[model samples]
Target: MPADDFSLRKIAIPAYGPTLLYGLATGAILPVIALSARGLGATVALAALVITLTGVGSLLTNVPATIVTTRFGEKWALVAASAWCALAMVLAASVPVLWVFAVAVFMVGMAGSVFGLARQSYLTEAVPVYFRARALSTLGGVNRIGVFIGPFAAAGAISLFGTAGAYWVGAAAAVGAGILSLQVPDLAVRSPGAGAAVSAPDAGPAPTVRSILRSHARVFRTIGIGVLLIAAVRATRQAVIPLWGQHIGLDPTATALIYGLSGAIDMLIFYPAGKAMDTWGRRSVAVPCMLIMGLGLGLLPLASEATGLLLAALLIGFGNGIGSGIVMTLGADFSPSPGRPQFLGIWRLLADIGTMAGPGILSGVTAAASLSAGIGATAVLGLLGAVVLWTWVPGRKAAVGSITG
Candidate 1:
C-alpha cells in the first residue's frame, strides 16, 4: 500500500498497449459506420439505430460475459473476447446492407463488452492496490490517444477508400489486440473472503445470475445512478455540439477540429487527474470535477463563438478526466468478486444505460423546447450527481486519515 509500491512504468505500459489499440480501432470505425449507413440511403433515424443496436448488444451480454470470466479466468476470457471481436469486425466490414451492418455492429459490441470487462478486471487484480487509481488513469489517458487518433484515421480512410475500407482497418487492429491479449499474464484467483472457500478451478460453482445480481445490489445501484447522471450530461454535449456548430454555420472541418481538440485535451489531462486520485482520494477529486463539468454544460448555450466553445471544451475535458478516473477506481475498490470481468460488466452495464439514454433525452428535449432547455437539463443532472457524491460518498480526508493513522 506504500506509494513507492505502485510502479507506474511497470504496470502501465503492458496493460495500455492492447487497450489503446482497441480504443483506436473502435473509435475510428464507429463514426464511419454511421456515415456509411447514411451514405447507403438509410434515414437519419435508422442511421442512429446503429448506435442503439450496438448498445443493446452490450447491455445484454455484459453481465454474462463477466460471469464467464469468473469461471474460465480473465486471461482466457480476454483472449477469446478479443478474437471474437476481431471476427465480428471483419464480418461487419463485408456486410453490404444497413440492417446486416447493424447486426454485425451488435455482435462487435457484445464481444467488445466482454473484452473490455476482462481487461479492466485484469488491471485491478494485477496492479497493486495503492497504485490502482493512477493505473486506471494511465490506462484512460493512453486509451484516449486512440480516441484522439481513430476518428482522424477513419476520416482519412473514408476520403480514400470509403467506410468499408475504414472497417477493414478496424478489423486488422482488432486482430492485433487479440494477439496482445495472448501476452497478458495469468494471476492466481483468491477466495472472496475467510468464510467463503475458493471455488475449484474446474468444478467451482459458476456465479449464478441471481447471486451476482443480489451481491452487487448496493454498489451497482449507487454507481449505476451516478453513472447514468454523468452519462446523460456527457451525451448531451456530444449530441448537441455538431448541430450547434452547423446551425452557427461552422464548416464540417471546423466541427471535426473542435471534437479532436477536446479529445486531445482530455488525453493530456487524464493522467495527472489519475495521479491526483491516488494522492488525494476518490471523493476529493470526483465531486468537484463533476461540479466543474456542470459549469461547462451550463455554459454551452453561451458558446456561440469559437473562444467560448474552446473554453467549454477545456472545462469538460478536465472534468471528465477526473470523473472517469475516480469512477473506475471506485468500481475496483467496491467489487465483491475477484473475477474482475463480472464486476466491470456490472459497472459498465449501468454506465452504458446512461450513455444510451443521454442522446435520446437531449434530442427529445431540444426538439420540444429550446437548446438552452436541453443544456439546462444536463447542467441540473450534473449538479445532482455532484450532490450525491458529496452527501453519500466518504471524503478523501477520512479515507486517508484512516489509512495513515
Candidate 2:
C-alpha cells in the first residue's frame, strides 16, 4: 500500500464510526447510573459502590477481552461486544432491584473492555507503523467527541422519558455501533503479508499468555510503570476539577460550563498532538503533557473563583489533550506481532489499575488530610509520571519508521 493511499481519511468511517457510538453509549449511561440506583432504593454509599463496579468490570475483563479478540478477530469481537453491551444496557434500564442493575452495569463495562481492545488491536494491525500514532490518537479523540455529546443526548432522553430513557439511548448507540462494525472491512484478509519484516522465524508452538507476560517483563516494569502513572494523573484530573469547583462554591451550572469548555480545548488538540508525535517523537509530547498537568494541579488549589478555575481546568485539559493517544501508541510500538493482543491486554490492565488508584488516592488523602492535600498528592504523581516517561518511553526514531521491504 502506498503511504499516501493509506491516509486516515481513507479509513475514517470504518476505523472510527463504531468507537464514536461505543463512546456515546458509555457516556450516556455513566451520569445516570447513580441516579438510577438511588431510584431503585439504594443508599448513597451503595449507589457509589454500584458505580465503582463499572471500573471493576473493565479491570477484570482486560486480559480476558484480549483472548476473545485474538480468537474471534477484531470485527467479530467488536460486533459481539456491542451486542453484549446493548443487552446489558437494557437490563440496566429494566431491572427493578439495585443489585441486578449493578450487575448489568458491570456487564456493560466488561463489554466495553472487549470493544476497546478489539478496536485498538485492529488499528495496530491495519495502520502502517508510520501512521500508528495519528491513527490511535484520532481513535481516542473520536471517542472523546462521542463522550462529549453523550450527556446532552442523555439529558434529552431523561426529559422525554425519565431516567430510564438514558439507558435506552445507550442501547440504541450500542446497536448502532454493532451495525457499523459489520461495515469495517477485514483488513487482515486484505494484507496478510504486509508486516513480514517484523515477523520472526516459525517457533515450535504459539506463545501462551503466561509466556508472553514473561517475555515482556522488562517492558511491563519500565514503560508500563509510566503508563500506570499517566492513567493515574488523567483520572485524578477528571475527579478533581468538579470537586474543587464545588469546594470554591461555584454553582453546578457554572462548574459544568467550565468543565465543558475545558473539554472543548481538549478535543481541539488531538490531531496536532498525534502529528507532532509522528514527526517530532512521542517523548516530545508525553513529557510536556505530564509536566503541564502536574503544574496545573499544583496550582489548582489557589483558584477561589470561576475564572481561576476555568484557567486551571483549561491548562489541565491542554496537557491531557496533547497526550491523547500516548498510552495506546506506546502499546502498539512495543507489542510483538505474534502476541500483540496478549501484550496489549497486560498493558491495559496496568492503565486500569492506575485509573482506579487515582480516585482512591484522592479519596484516601482527603479523608486523612484535606482536599487540597489530595490534589497536591496527585500533582506530585503527574510530575513523577513525566519523569518516568522521560526515562523509559523511547523516541520516535526508536519506535517507528516507514517500511522499505
Candidate 3:
C-alpha cells in the first residue's frame, strides 16, 4: 500500500477515546492539586512540593517502564499504565496525609510516562511517514479537548459533592481510558534498521536498554538534547503566563479567561500544523513554533494593558498549538523501530527534567532581577531552542529516511 494511503482515521481514532479520558482525568486533578494539599493541612511550601513530585516521579521510572514495554507491547503497556493511574487516583482520594496524596500523584505521573511513551511508540510503528504528523497532532488535539472540558466537569462534580469529587472524576477517566486502551489496534512493529514494518513477533530477542542507547547515541545527543530545550520552553510558558498576568494587575477571572482563550486558539490548529509538518517539513512547524512562542513570552512583560496581554497570550497559544505533537513526532521520526519504548523512556526522562526545572529557572531569575528580566531570559531560551532545532534537527526531506533506526 502507498504511504499516502495510510488513513488518519485509523491512526487517530484508536487513540482518540483513551487519550481524551487520560487528559480529563489529569486535568480535573491539576487545577485543584495544590488546594487538595492545603486542605490536608500542609503548609504552602509543602503544597508546592506536592505538585512538583509528579515530574520527579516520572524521572524515577525509565528503567522499570522500559522493561514493562519490552515485555508487553505498547497496547498492553498503556492498559496497565492507565489501570495503575486509576488505582493511584483512588489511593489519592482515600489518603488523609499530604505525603500519601503526593505519592499517589507521583504514581499517576509515572504511569503517565508509560502510557504516553507506549502511545507514541505504537503510533511510530503503525502510522506511515506521510500521515504520521496528522495522526500525532490529532492525538494532541484530542488531549487538549479533554483538558479544556475537564474543569467544567469537575465544577459540576464539585458542586454536587466537593473538591474530593474531582478525584472521582479523575478515577473514572483513568478507568475509561484503560478500557478504551484495550480496543486499540496492535500494529506489528518492525525491527530496528528495517526499511519497512513487519510482524516482528520474533523481533530477535527484544533489544536491551544499554544496546538501544549505544545505537541511538547520535540522535540522543543531537535531537534528544534539542527537545529538552523545547520542553523547558513549553513548561516555562505555562509557569510564566499566570505570573505575568498577575504582574500586569489582571484579576483572577480575567487571567483565566485570557489563558483559556489562548488555549482554545491553540487547540483549534493542530490538524493544520500536522498537515504542514507532513507536507512541508518539521522545520516549518518547529522553527515557527519556537520563534512565535519566544516572541510572545518576551513581549508579554511589556504589555501593561489587558488587550495587549490578550494578544501576546493568543500569539503564544498559536505557537503552542502549532507544536501540538512536535516533540512526539520528532521522537517517532528518530526512534529505532523495534526499540522505541526504551529510547522514548530515556527521551521522556530528559524532557521531563527540563519541564521540572523551568519553573525554578523563572523564579530564580525573577528573584535575582525583575519579572521582565526573568521573562526575557525564558524567551531567549525558547529562541535558543528554535536555533537548536534549525541547526540540529533535520529538515523535512532530509529528516525522512535519514535514520536507519
Give residue 176's error in model 2 in angstroms. 0.5
* lDDT string, candidate 1, 1-405, tens digits: 233554546645457777887887787787776787787678888888886777788888878886768777777777787777777777767767777777788887887788767777777767666667777777767777876677777777667777777787777777777777777766644443221111222345655545555766665566557766776776666766666667667788887777667666767777678777778777777787779888988887788876677677678776776765666677666654533455567778877788787777777787899777877787788899898776655566554212110
lDDT of each: 0.70, 0.87, 0.82
Our tally of clashes for model 3 stands at 0
Q: Kindly report which residue stretches of model 3 are placed more than 4 angstroms away from their true locations once superposed.
A: 1-5, 189-205, 399-405
The TM-score, computed over Cα atoms with residue i paired to residue i, of candidate 2 is 0.95
Evaluated at residue 380, the lDDT of candidate 2 is: 97
Error of 3 at 216 (Å): 1.7
Q: What number of backbone clashes does candidate 2 have, counting pairs of residues 3 or more apart or in separate chains?
A: 0
Top-scoring candidate (lDDT) = 2
Candidate 2, residues 197-270, lDDT tens digits: the string is 24343455675678778877887888889999999999989889999999999999999999989899999999
- TM-score-superior candidate, 1 or 2: 2
Q: 236-319, model 3: which lDDT tens digit per residue? A: 888777788898898989988888889899999999999999899888899899999999998999899789889999999999
Off by more than 4 A, model 2: 1-5, 189-201, 399-405
Kindly report which residue stretches of model 1 are placed more than 4 angstroms away from their true locations once superposed.
1-8, 155-160, 191-209, 338-340, 397-405
